[model samples]
Target: MITPKASPAVFAVGSLTVDVKGTIGGTYLDLTSYTATASSVSFNPLGGYDFSFRENDGLSSKRTLSISLRNLLIPSPPDYSESVVTERGIFVYEYDMKSSSTIAVTQPNPNLYRYAFNDFKLSGKARHTDDTREITCNGFFLLQELTWPL
Candidate 1:
């Protein structure tokens, strides 16, 4: 017999926050967009006609998070402070997604994906125009592990 297919789940952004030495702070409410990138490098050894072996260098792996927010009159605290940029903290991205209804029915909670950057830095450039002003923060995630809640 043919089996039925389940519907695709819909995921939405819940919130983003930074944790500094156990103190958590929220970003401006006008956050417009955010993106994350995880990457690594690989080496390939070529034989006579084709590649013989492929290897991945664990040390080359890196993760980075970038966020764009609407400019606020007040300056961001330690998260964006030059004196504290080198400090390590946890960057969290919470997501709300539709769960599978076939197994169980219940209220959905936001799922969190946390990244522990050994040396988290908050640096960005702000652009001002006649309409609006936005700032973008792009920094390194100096670690390789990402924690998830199941």
Candidate 2:
């Protein structure tokens, strides 16, 4: 008898929470989509013509998270407060996905990927009548943590 392989899992966007001054916000704007990008720098040392050496520059790595929210209605004062535009805060994003039997059997049935952006600061915000409002944030790095079905 042949063993069946585990099926692929479906992943979805869970939630995005903004922590401002120890208070959590971001309930007013209807978040539609978001994208996270991370980049690292590489260094190459001078070597012989036949040999080359390369190394990753961890210190120059950066993480950027951009979110687009539908402007269903006007946001309240606290939801998109002025502080969010002026001050720096922390952003937490959660992604959930079901796991295959083989993976689930060893770990949790469902997998949770939590990304925490420290020293996250608002890079820009754009709003237009014909376009969705977008918020861009940049951070030094992202701290990724994993949790089992919860």
Which residue pairs clash in candidate 2?
none
RMSD of 2: 19.5
In angstroms, the error of model 1 at 98 is 33
Question: What does candidate 1's lDDT look like per residue over 1-150, in tens digits?
Answer: 965555322222222222222112323345333333333212213311110111121222212222211211111111121111213643222211121111111222333222222233332322221122122322322211123333
Summed backbone clashes in each candidate are: 0, 0
For each candidate in turn, the TM-score is 0.19, 0.21
Score candidate 1 by lDDT. 0.24
Residue ranges of candidate 2 with Cα displaced over 4 Å: 10-16, 19-114, 127-150
Sequence-dependent TM-score of model 1: 0.19
> Which 10 successive residues of model 2 have the least lDDT summed?
48-57
